[model samples]
Target chain A: MEYLSMLPGPTNVPNRVMRAMLAPIINHRSDDFVELYTDVVDKTQQVFQTKNDIVALSASGTGAVEASVINIVKKGDKIIIPVNGEFSGRLAELIEAQGAHVVKLQTPPGQNATFDQVKEAFDNNKDVKAFYVVHNETSTGTMVNYLDRISDLTSRNDSMYIVDSVSILGGVNLPVDKWNIDVCMTGAQKAIAAPPGISPISVSPKAKKYMIANPPPTMYFNLARYFKYYEESKHTPFTPALPLLYAYREALSIMLEEGLEHVFKRHKVCSDALYSSLSAIGLTPFAKQEDRSISIIALNYLDGLEDKIFRDTLADKFKVLVAGGFGNLKGKVFRVGCMGEVNKYHVMRTVSAISSTLAMMGYKTDAQAGLKTAEEKLKAL
Target chain B: MEYLSMLPGPTNVPNRVMRAMLAPIINHRSDDFVELYTDVVDKTQQVFQTKNDIVALSASGTGAVEASVINIVKKGDKIIIPVNGEFSGRLAELIEAQGAHVVKLQTPPGQNATFDQVKEAFDNNKDVKAFYVVHNETSTGTMVNYLDRISDLTSRNDSMYIVDSVSILGGVNLPVDKWNIDVCMTGAQKAIAAPPGISPISVSPKAKKYMIANPPPTMYFNLARYFKYYEESKHTPFTPALPLLYAYREALSIMLEEGLEHVFKRHKVCSDALYSSLSAIGLTPFAKQEDRSISIIALNYLDGLEDKIFRDTLADKFKVLVAGGFGNLKGKVFRVGCMGEVNKYHVMRTVSAISSTLAMMGYKTDAQAGLKTAEEKLKAL
Candidate 1:
């Protein structure tokens, strides 16, 4: 049974993208692969809205995030990470693992770090090497709404601005170049609608310069090696996951064909519909209105509604698979992904399924009202 | 045109394995994913022939090798790596990147590090932390044939025995437990015939203890985190490449169904055919017969045969893709993969293709004789 994936990532891959995986494997060093890889990288740069070189890594999103950190942050380097959710907190830990002194600007799980908070962190810390932040905190369904504003502080301080846009990039407007983002990493499975595994990360020339000067003592996650290989042969340093590359190329083509404006607008409509519909069904939105994620929709569990039972019922009965919360929010919030190939049909079915599941769990919810609300919002798509 | 992949890795994925990737994405934390992941790990362990725990990392073969090295070798740790081929040399570099003192046992290309040479290294270096070797060096088509014996040396010295069996595990008999290999890593694409990306690595209890005692400062490649996640739920530390996992599971299923003994025998017969046929066509085998890789057959280019022109003719004219030699052997040798789904038909087709390509290049070669030789050897399969 194929349950609808409504989790934050590894979302419902479109048939076009999934079918692309059926293409025969090709030699990564071959001309055909060079063409496929170059095209994928170019399309990835377009989606990132950056002129920076993109490296398609054959690892998960976390690997790319690690690459972004280990490449720039050396020992004793002070790096500021605004931790608002599980993903951001993990990023801080990853930086600390590099022997860097992480100055974390802690925020409540449901809220994002404001520009003022980050600016103050920059002011407090001297010679900060980098500012790392998760653009979209999938765990809490919160997004930093002030990244464009915060980029200014990093720019003024001359610190590398690294953004983990794993859950947001293709679905949201993240202009890496405009924001002066030195490194922006994203997973293929998220808004890109490709299969999981490949993470296409955009690296600015500044970041590349820093990395080449102080190369990480790593082989597989070494960004400098990727740059060298890309420059020399339009190839990854290692054998890439060829099928995922194919799927990613196709997914990016779909995104480009629809136009980034339309893709971002569709994501906005879908997430809006989810938020409004779930809110109407007596489920409170987890994040504050101003900071809610436009990709992952997080909702507080209704009073007396069991978390496992609710999700289980949704999966087993409705075949709609949603995610329970992570860390502190576990059993308190449920997350539904509104990114990646999500359309009016998906939004409507998800709203109806949640409504029906909650009602089945003996919660007071109007299924018709939820569906109508979702239908109205999705009309924008 | 879909050229047949005969490279050392990213081999021709079977249609069943490729189609398995079309399965819709699922939540990594879900029970369904747990089932899928657990089964894949179990089958991977079977291929590895190990009773140890297997960590299926969502990275390439090199990433797994990096994980194995970084997890165990701390700063200033002395690790002996035999450098005979490109892969082994890279392994030494990865170990060195971890700030470990790499004592390289340098052997010429197309030759394996003898048991005596490794023993000499261990004797000379006191308190050696580990002994790393590439079981099948794909770049030079050479394999260390004394791993079982070398494992004893590491066991006696209480050093970790790490083996990079990335290109040969499924198609060859590598009993990790029997050989006392502390860390054995293999990629899914090579021999396993799954699409590349996921690298399933087996860790013995001893290696795990050492890793837990001295954890690497890494997030994504952290083996400890993987252990914790697998213990809590049959899940990886982060989101896995779901479609690749599906393909890996199907590929493993095919391997298990065929039985390891039969698989190993088939690989032996296939390589035997390639060796006899290609040798008959006047292309000398690059690796000495004693140390040659059974999975990757490396043959020297005939005198006056241009490497690019020969391989191009093979690819364009006959729709067969083979690899050129690496490093010093570039343009000197050609490699054909005789692993995974490679049977009598592929053997005959490849032999005929090579012979005809050589003939087309104005070289003296008997295509009929090569085909007949391949047919005679493939009868064993």
Candidate 2:
């Protein structure tokens, strides 16, 4: 049985993107593959909104995030990472694993790191080599709203500004160049609406120069090799997931064809619909209104509702798959992803499914009210 | 136009395997995903012929090779690697990049590392932490023939035995358990016949214990995280390339369905056919007869035949894509891979294409004779 994927990511891939994987595999070093790779890099740069060099690594989003850290920061260097959600905590761990000193700017779950919090950390740790932040916290359904401001602080301090925009970039209007984000990485499976496995990362000239001078002790995730191969022959240093790349290119094409502004607007409208509709059905939005993510909707379970039973019922009975919160938020909240091809029909069906499921579980829910709210919000799209 | 892929890697994916990727994306943490991941791991073990735990990484073959090195060999640890061709040379580089002292067992191209060469290195480097070797060198189409013997040496020395069987695993018989291989990694695109990207790596208990005791500095390629996730949740530590995992499982299913013995025999027969037929058409096999690989057939270029012109004609006119030699072998030899769903038709067609392309380039070649030789060898299968 096919179920709608409402998780933060691996979001729903379109038929056009999925069908693109069926193309026969080609030699990665051949001219045909070079053309394909070049086209993908070109399209990827447009989506990233940066003139920086872009490379698609055959890895998950986490791999690219790790690459961003290891490629620039040395063993003894100090780096500041803000921690709020599970993904942000992971970012800290990744930096710590590199033997670098990570000054984590701690924030409460459900709240994003404030500009003041980042400024204090940077002031305390004066010799920071880099400042890494998760643009969208998938676990808490929150986003760092002041990234443009944070970039300015990093630029003034001469620290590399790295962003993990895995689940948000395509859904949100993130102009990497305009924000002065030195390094930003996103997954193909998220808002890109491609299959997972390929992470498209954009590296600014500053970051590239640093990496070349102090090369990371890595072979596969080596960004220098990627740049060399891209410059010499438009190809990846190692064999890439060919089918996934094809799907990624097709997904990017679809996003471009629809226009970035329109896609971002669609994500905002759909997510806004989810927030209002779910709220009308007696579910509380977990994150604060100002910090809530536009890509994922985090909603609290009704009183006395079991996490597993609720998610299982929504999946088994209603054929809708959402995700439970991570770490401390596990039993408290469930996340519904509203990115990557999410439309009015998807929002309506998901709202209807959740309300009906709640009603079946003996909860007092106004299903019609929720559907009406969703319809009202979606009409704006 | 659909061309027959005869390259060493990114081999032609079977239709059944390709169709497996068309399944809609599911929640990776769901029971459905767990079952899928568990099934793929189980089938992967069967192909590996080991009771060791297998982890499918969302990386290419090179990434897995890097994992094998970084996970086991620590900084300042002494390691020995046999460098005969491009891949084994890379193995040495990966080990050295970890701040480990590498004692290279140098062997000439087109020649497999002799058992004596490995033994000498082990004797010279008494405190070696690991012994790494490439089972199949894709660049030169040569393979280490005495892996079982080397495994005995590694066992006696109490050093980790790591093998990069990327280009030859499924088509050749190198039982992981029987040979006591501590860590063995292979790619999906080679003998496995799946699309490139996912690498299946098997880890023995010994290797796992050492890794847990002294963890690697890397995060993305961390095997401990993979073990914890697999044991507790039957899932990967991070979001995997879901479609590629599906393709890998289907490819494993196909390989097991064909039976390992039958698959190995098919590979041997096909390579033998290519060797004999190409020789009959006046081409010399690059590797020595005893050390020649059963998966890839490397042959020297005919005199006065331009490398680019010859390969382009073969690809454009005959619609058969093979690979040219790498590094020093470039423009000197060409390679034809005979693995992963490579049957009578592919062999006969490749042989015919090479001969015809040679004849078109004003070199004397017997196209009919090459086809006849391939037909005779294929009749045995």
Candidate 3:
């Protein structure tokens, strides 16, 4: 049986999207593929609310982040990253792995970095080449605010601003061009509602210029080569995963059909409902107030409750698949993804399932409390 | 209309494979995905004919090639590469991009690198860290012979032996263990008959050890990380392309059920039939007779015919897809891929289509002559 994949990525695939993926694979250089790429890239830019260039890469979201970093800066360059969640830590590691020096704007999980905190990193690093941030911290369900402020500071300096919006691109309002982001990328499996193995990355003129001057010699994730090929042949330098592009096209159609503002508001309604439901069941979210993500909801296990056993109960008994925290947050909280096709029904079921599971484990909780709260919030939608 | 994708890499995916690809995508870190990955990796080894570690990367074949290079050696290291085809040229460039010194055993297209030539390069550049070869050079349809001899030479020294069998791994006989190949990678779209996203790479213990020590800073194509993740958790370090893995498992099952020996023999039979039919049509293959590939057939265009227009006529009129050459060989010849589900019927149809297209284009050709030859060769199969 196919479980409902409520993880941050590789979520449930809609029937139309799956059918789209069933189309026979096409040659990457074929006219059909180029049209597909061009159309998808064009639609992707509209969803991103940007007129900048976007590249569709055939790899995981982490690979897109690597492409951004490696293409922009090389060894000995300094990059400042805000390290709050697992993905942010990954960016920092990837930056250092490229032989670049990294200065961390450290923040606790579920917390946002103020503009002054980012400035502190820049002040200490002085001559920083780039600033990396995770727009939505999937690890703790913290959607960081003050990105515009951070972008303003980075723009004043010569540092390029890169954001990993992997878990919350379409569902969140991160107007890439307006925020002055040098590069922003997200994978298909998350809010885009497509399968994994493909990620779309948008690049500002600033980042494109940086790539042209100092290109990485990578055979894959070579954005400069990709840009050149798209300019010349309107295709990727390497073979793209054709099937995923079809699915992405269908997903983007769904997004555009729903309209961007309506999609964001849908996420907001579901997120608010989930937050209220969890609170009604006496569960506190891991994220700080106003920093909680519409993409995911991370809730800490009540004192004396076993997190793993609770999650396993949800998966095994109710067949509700949720994710556990990573790194420092492991075994302390569970993460429920509300990205992509998640809606009021899924939110209500999730909250109800959690409440019932807690009560099944002998915890003091009202049986219909979470569900009632969710219904009240979702009634208007 | 979904035209046949008969290109070397993105061949027509079978119906069963397409159906398998329709499965709901699961979380990459879920128990289901781990099981799927383990099962697929084990079966992939059977098709690869090796007991070595196999990594399933979410990028194209070129990404896998880069992973092999970055994992094995870094800057200032010496390596020897054979530049007989377009792919080998790519290998040389990748080596330089990694800041390594490349010693080239150069040969023109349609030619195979001699063992003597490789030895000469290694002798001149002593203590070479690695030796790179393309088992099936997709560019000119040349499948190099005497790899065991070349592997023996590389073995005599401590040079790591890496092979790019992107176009011909399952169809051609490349015994990884017996041949002492450190790493051999192939794309899913080729002989495996899966979609284009994932590439299976078999790595020997020697290569794994080398990778552990000289790890590439790559986020996506880190084979060492993949190895560790598989060992500890039986999954990829990053999000894997789930749907492709399902289809790949089905594809592998198809090959194994048919038997590897039979699969290889089928490819041989098809290759022989195509060669005879092409000969009957007065088309000279680009590759040397003995160096011809079982997976693809590349033929030099007749002196006066435009290869591009001929290819377009085939696509527009007959709905047949064949590729042309790249780099120096561009516009020189056209390539027909006969891997995966391609068989004697497809070959007959292709040869007939080519002859018919040539005839329509005012060339003197017997359209039925090629079909007659193909049928005779395919009768025994």
Candidate 4:
């Protein structure tokens, strides 16, 4: 059975990308594959808006996070991480796993880190050599808007500014070069509209030099090794996921065709329509409008309904797959992904499905009203 | 124009697997995804012929190699690595990168290590805690035939045994339990016939305990952490490459339906036919009879023809992709892989392409005679 993927990642891939992905495999070291690899890297750099070298690894986005930490941070080096949601929480765990000291500036669930909190943490931790922050928190649908300020703070102190834009890379306003992101990373499956298994990471010379001085106890996800291999030959150290690379190249082409600014505007429209439609059905977004994500929307259905029951009913009965809350936000919220190739119609279908499911479950929801609101919003956009 | 992939690992994926891979993405944390993940792991264990639990990582096979070394071998632990081919040489490098003491028992580029050499290395290295070997060296087309005997030697010496079956997993005969292999790893892009990006690893209880006792300085490739996640949640700690997993499940289903022994037999037939046909076209197999790969064949066109010229002509004119050698064997040998989802027709096409390219290069080659030999050999099989 087919289901509409509305999760924060692994969203519905377009047929164009699927056809490219199913193309016959090519030898990775072949000239044809070098063209594909180099094109993808160049396109990725454009999307990242940086002159920093981009290295694609056959790994998940978390693997890229591990690569950034293990490569740049020396052992026992203190890194200030702003914890806002599930993904940001995982950053702490990943840093600790790599034997680095993590100074976490905690924020409430479904909220972004305030400037005061971030500045206070920076002032308190003078030994911090790096600042890692999640640009888009996938769990609670929050996006940090103070990243440029944070980058300025890090640069003034001569520290690295690393950003995790896994969920909002192509769908939101993230200018890596403008913000001077020393290291920024994203996964292909999230906002790139490609199948997963490929992580595209950008590394400036500062991060590269730090990595050369303090190498990680890693070989596969070693950023410098990837850089060396790319510099020598436009190929990964190992045989990469060739099919996925095909899909990634095609997806990036699609995004570029639409243009990044227009893509971000479309996502904002989709997110706004979803909010209006969901509110028509008595469901409210979890995060504030300023900190809310254009890539995803987290909704609260608090009329004596369990989060699993709501999401499971929507998935099994309506064939719409949304994600349940994770970590500390479990049972409080459910997320709908609006990234990738999702259009207004996709968001409309999700909103319609949710309204129908709520009505079926005896919750107070007007399916027709929700559909009308969504259609009007889409038409206005 | 479409090309026939003849690389060592990124081989030709079957149409069935491709169609499955093009299926829409799903929520990875959903029950449907869990079913898919667990079934793939089970089938992987069966293909490995071991009851050990399978840990599938959404990374390249190199990530699995890093996991085996960093997780199982402690810092400063001595490991006995016999470097013969490019892959085995890479094993030594990976071990050394993890701060392990590598005792290299080196062999010639195109030769397999003898039993005496392997035994003498273990006998001399008293502090060796592990012995890692590549079952099928993809570069020189050498398969380690004396693995069971080597397993016995390692067991008697109280050291762990790890095998890398990256180039020849499902198409070759590898009895992990019967050979007492502590940790055996294979990539999805090899004989498994799936798209690249997933590494399936089978680990015994002994290796698990050792890893739990001494955790590696890793987060992404940490086996015990993966084990714990699998034990509790039956999911990867990070977002996996979902489409590749779908492709992997379908490919494993195809292999199981064909039966492992029949699969192995078919590979042997194809390899034999390719070897005979290439010989008819004035190419000599690189390795000895017993050590030659049943899944891949490396040939030396030893009439002073540049490797690049031959491979490039074949690829450009006939649209057939072959591999140039790596490490010390570079520019001396070319390789053709006849693993997973490959048949006699594929072999015939490859052999014909090589002969035609040689003929185009003003070399002595009997194109019709090679085709005739390949047909006769295939008919006999």
Give me the candidate number with maximum DockQ: 2
Q: Which regions of candidate 1 fall more than 4 Å away from where they truly are?
A: none
Which is superior by DockQ, 1 or 4? Answer: 1
lDDT of 1 by residue, A156-229 (tens): 88888888999988998988898888899999999998888899899888889889898888888889998998
Model 3, runs deviating above 4 Å: A123-126, B123-126
* Model 4 chain A lDDT-worst window of ten: A210-219
> Each model's TM-score, in the order given?
0.98, 0.99, 0.97, 0.95
Pitting candidate 1 against candidate 3, the one with the higher DockQ is 1
Arranged by TM-score with the best first, the candidates are 2, 1, 3, 4
Q: Can you write out model 4's per-residue Cα lDDT over A1-381, one digit (the tens) per residue?
A: 688888899888888988998677877887777889999999999899988989887888888888887787776888999897778988888788767888888878778878888888888877689999998999999988888788767976778899988888998878888988999999999889898888899999888887767666667877777788888988778888888889899999999999998888888888888988898878889998788888889998666888878888988898999888887777888889998987887888898899888888888777887888888888755
- Model 2 residue A146 distance off true place after TM-score fit, in angstroms: 1.0
Q: Candidate 3 on A15-122: residue-level lDDT in tens?
A: 898899877677777787788999999999999889999998998898898888889868999888888888888888988988998888788888878777778777
**How many Å off is the CA of B109 in candidate 1?**
0.8
Candidate closest to the true structure, highest TM-score:
2
Top-scoring candidate (lDDT): 2
- Error (Å) of candidate 2 at residue A143 is 0.7
lDDT (10s digit) by residue, model 1, range B1-381:
677778888888898988888777878888888889889888888888888999988889998988988888888999898898888888888888778888998988998778888888888886998888888998889977787787768877878888899999888888989989999999998898888999999999988987888888888888988898888877888888889899899999999999999999999999999999888888789998899999998888877788899898999999999999887889999899988888888888888888888878788887777888888888897
Inter-residue clash pairs, candidate 3? none
User: What's the distance in Å from true for residue B240, model 2?
Assistant: 0.8
lDDT assessment of candidate 1: 0.88
lDDT of candidate 2 over A75-168, digit per residue (tens): 7889988898888998888788877888888888889778888898888877888899999999999988888888768877889899999988
